[model samples]
Target chain A: MKTLLNKDQLNITLQRLAHQLVENHLSFKDTAIIGIQPRGIYLSDRIAHMVRNITGQKRIDYGRLDITFYRDDVQSRDIQVPSDTDIAFSIENKSVILIDDVLHTGRTIRSAMDALIDYGRPKNVELLVLVDRRFSRELPIQPDYVGHTVDTILTQKVKVYWKEKDGKDEVVLIDKV
Target chain B: MPLSVKHLLGIKELTVQDIEQIFQTADEFKQVLQRPIKKVPTLRDTTVANIFFENSTRTRLSFELAEKRLGADVVNFSASGSSVSKGETLIDTVNNILAMKVDMVVMRHSASGAPWFLANHIDASIVNAGDGINEHPTQALLDSFSIRERLGSLKGKRIAIIGDIMHSRVALSNIYCLAKLGAEVTVSGPPTLIPKHIESLGVRVEYNVKKALEWCDVANVLRIQLERQHKPLFSTLREYALFYGINKQMLDGLKKKIIIMHPGPINRGVEINSDVADSGQSIILNQVENGVAIRMAVIYLLSGKKDAQLSI
Candidate 1:
């Protein structure tokens, strides 16, 4: 396992991403932010907090989306207990930004897109990721906002850890021997 | 893990973990039901045949809707006006259906173990919709699902299976399922209607309906199987209703909030009063709604598509 981003690097990347979000979404009136469930939630929560701090916004509409049922590999894997999806506000005619920790197969993003439609049709949707594992995407999905781009093989797995969840914030790439 | 069994023959064949797995899958499908599209292309290439030798409206329609919603090609086969009426054997009829490249068979037969028998003879997956008084696995599953939904867990919860225990497949299946899930089960009914050796199944036997109601957290009232009864178990319907029937007054008399559940085709005045069936405490309608999702979960898991995902 190789450590790609330590605590300092992770914090710097989050601030940069939050600043970029504020620059593009400027008051975020008709904009909504959603975090992919299980892993993406921590990053989305961190970014949402950073964005609120940087933009001085009172409340940024953020929610969690679970794409377990919408995935392309339901039966093959062990039965999964689905996480809570708590989208309280409507995404109708809003600019929606979907956040995740890692982008590899791109199937998770595709499932997230499919699941997002069930809430309501958004005017537009964009993707943001903490780690973009280039050349391994199964679907034609590209992240609009990327924190780090790492070149990895199909055999390697990239994981992001947060202090709130893992007691430390770091991104690691585990390679199969 | 995904269910290890190739076919869902009965609740007897399913472990507690298997039932929980099915419920977890159903939970996901329940959310799908709430969506606007209300359909998922999960079983796109799969084909299922609903073969009912006995007559049914709710179970048949529920299974059909589940199959359709999961994007499976469905073929409905009723025994009436078919080869079975012309004295064809069960295997012959199923074999003929299987010849059509049917992937799975959802069967409801008048005779017990019909699905099990078919499972042994055929290569296709067999799901027992209901097989006589033997077991109705899906009904039991949905009942447990509804209980878990309302109460949050089944462990050590008190459930009273009221009325016709002797002839109820729901009672048998529920006994196995609820007991396996760590619920305290009590079968309450008149002496003749309560099956023999039921206590051996690890449930208390309650003779008085009022006392049973007072003891249980949930009362699953069942309709007296009028068609299945060759000899009269009770003298009159009025006498049974007066003694064992669940009504609003009886519920109010309990002075404790208890969830009311009934496997459908309820004998309105005979087993349960119309008012109580439609009351605030009743989860009968939720049971019906959950039936579709439960069936979809069963069909999806049994579809045997190792890597298939929900599409569209």
Candidate 2:
């Protein structure tokens, strides 16, 4: 296992991502920040809080989106427990930023895009990732904001950890045993 | 924990954890139902068949809508106008449908254990909508879901299932579900309507409606099911109404607020009065609304997709 990001490095990267969000989406009037469920939710929470603090916005629209039902491999799995999709507000005409922890094959983002349309058509949509695994794209998808880019073989896995959840802040690359 | 069984044939075959997991999944689907677009794409690659060997309106339509909302292609097969009228066997009928590439079967038959039998023979997933007086797993699930939604939990809650107990799949399934979830269950009706050896199921049998109502936090009143009655079990409808029917006057005389519930196609004045059925304490309509979500959850879970990590 290789430690790709330590605590301080992860904090700086998140701060940079937060700043980029505020700079790109000024005032965030028609913007909606959606965190992909499970892992992406933690990253989205961190970024949404930081963006709100930096922009001094009282109530920025934030929601959690689960794409379990919209996945391409529904027939191939053993068990599927769907997560909560708590998007109370309309995403119609809003600039949507989809946040995920790591972007690998890009299939999850594709499913998220398909799931988002059922709620409403967004004015625009962008992807943000904490880590982007390069040269492993299965779909025509790329991240607009990336914290780190790592190159690896097909057998490797990138594991992300958070202080609130995993009792630490780090990203690790584990080789297939 | 997730539902380990491939088919939802009966509540008797389910554990408390399985019931709770279905409710948890149904909770998420209920949120999806509240959205502007009340559909998910989880079962897009799948196909479900609604094979009703008996006549139905609510159960058939609920299963169809649930399948559609989950983006599954559905085929409705009724025995009335189909080859089953020509003496086709249940296995032959389902096998033919399976040959058409159906992935799941939601069946309601006049005979008990039809879905269970089909599950044993067929490769496709099976969900028993209602099999004679055997079980209606989804109805029990949605009923539990509604109870949990209103009362917060099923543990230690006193629930009385009133009216026809012998011919009601709802009562049997509810009894199994409530008992498994640790709810105090009581069945009240005429002695003939209450099944023999029902006390063996760990439920108290009450002959008087007032006594049952006085002891319960919720009363699930079932329709008399005149179609299923082979002989007149009571003197008349009026006599049954006088003895067991639920009315506003009877409820008001109790001097306490108790939840009222009825499985639909209500007999108006036979089992539950219109005044009480339409009253504030009645959750009949909410049960119907939760039916779609509950069925969607069942279908989605049994469709064999990988489980997503649940935050809650």
Candidate 3:
């Protein structure tokens, strides 16, 4: 296993990503940050928290989205316990930042997009990922703001850990068993 | 988490973990219902058949709506005008339905153990809507869910199943479900309506309605099954209501506010007065609302089971 980002590096990368978001969305008036549920929530929470702190905006449009029900292979795949979704603010005519930890197959983004439009049609949507696993695009998806990009094969995996859940903030790459 | 059990036939067979799983899933489903577009496509490729041998309005509609919300193609069958009136057998009827690629069956039958009988002979999953005064699992589930919504938990809670326990599948199912979840239960009514030796089921029996209402944290008044009365169990509805029916006065007399619930098709003044049924304390409508989610949880959790077996 390789340590892609240690604790200090992860914090630095998060600040960079947060700055990138603040740079694009000044005042965040027409921008919304949505974190995909389960693991994406950690990345979204960190990025959203940092963006709010950097911009000093208390009422920033932030939400959590669960795409378990919107998956294309819901039946054929292993059953996953669904997480809660709480998108209170209006996404209508707003640019939504769809955040996730890792961008691999891009199916999660597809399902997240399908689930997001149900709330309301956003003006546009942007992708953000902490680790961009290049050459692993099952769908035509790319990240607008990437913290790090790694060349990985199908059998390898990228794991992101956060202090809130894993008791430490670190990114690691694991080889196949 | 996936449910340990495949089909929700009755609460009697369900473990506390299963009930907890269903309730936890239904919590998310409730959120789903509050959305602008209240539907999901999890079961888009699945088909479910709701076969009701007995008459129903709410349960049938609730199951249909739940199936639709889950994106399952629902085919409803009622025995009133169907070929069952033309001397067809139960297995024959179900087999015919199954032959057409039906994946799941939700049935309400007049005979006890009908779902069990059908489950033994069928390839598809079976959900017992209600089986002849034996158990109505989903109703009990929704009832407990409503109680949990109001009080936070069913553990150590005092729940009273008031009125006709003899003929109520809701009563029996509620007793089992509540007991399994660590709640104290009491069945209160006249001797005839309250069956003998029901204490064997681990619930207290109270002959007086006032005492039952006074001692309990929640009162789940059950409808006196007038249609199921083979012989006159009580002299008349008036006498039964006078002594046993839940009214506004009884609720007003309680020292503390207790959650009022009823699995509906409520007898206006027979088992519960209109004032109490429509009162703010009553979660009768919430029970109706939660039915869809609970049924959806059951259907979604079970839909994947048969396919898992079929693949092997």
Q: For each of the candidates, give the backbone clash count.
A: 0, 6, 0
Off by over 4 Å in 2: B305-312
Q: Name model 3 segments beyond 4 Å from true.
A: B305-312
Clashing pairs in 3: none
TM-score of each: 0.92, 0.96, 0.97
Per-residue accuracy of model 3 over B1-312 as CA lDDT, tens digit each = 666666678898888988988887788888888888899888999999999999999999999999999999999999999999999999999999999999999999999989988887888888999999899999999999999999899999999999889999999999999999999999899999888899999999999999999999999999989889999998989998899988899899889898899998899999999999999999999999999998888888777634444210
Ranking by TM-score: 3, 2, 1
Interface RMSD of 3: 1.7
Give one digit per residue, the lDDT tens place, for model 1 in A1-177.
999999999999999998899899998887888999989999999988888888788788898998866777754555455676778788989999999999998999999998898788999999999999999988899999999999999889998888999999999999987
- What are the clashing pairs of model 2? A69-B42, A79-B306, A79-B307, A80-B306, A80-B307, A81-B307
Higher DockQ: candidate 1 or 2?
Answer: 2
TM-score of 3: 0.97
Docking class for model 1 is acceptable
Best by DockQ: 3
lDDT for each residue of candidate 2 in A1-177, tens digit (9 for 90 to 100): 999999999999999999999999999889999999979999999999999999999799999998887888878866567778878789999999999999999999999999999899999999999999999999999999999999988999999999899999999999997
**Whole-model Cα lDDT per candidate?**
0.89, 0.90, 0.91
Per-residue alpha-carbon lDDT of candidate 3 for residues A1-177, written as tens digits (9 for 90 to 100): 999999999999999999999999989999999999989999999899999899999989999999888888866755666788989888999999999999999999999998999888999999999999999999998899999999999989999999999998999999988
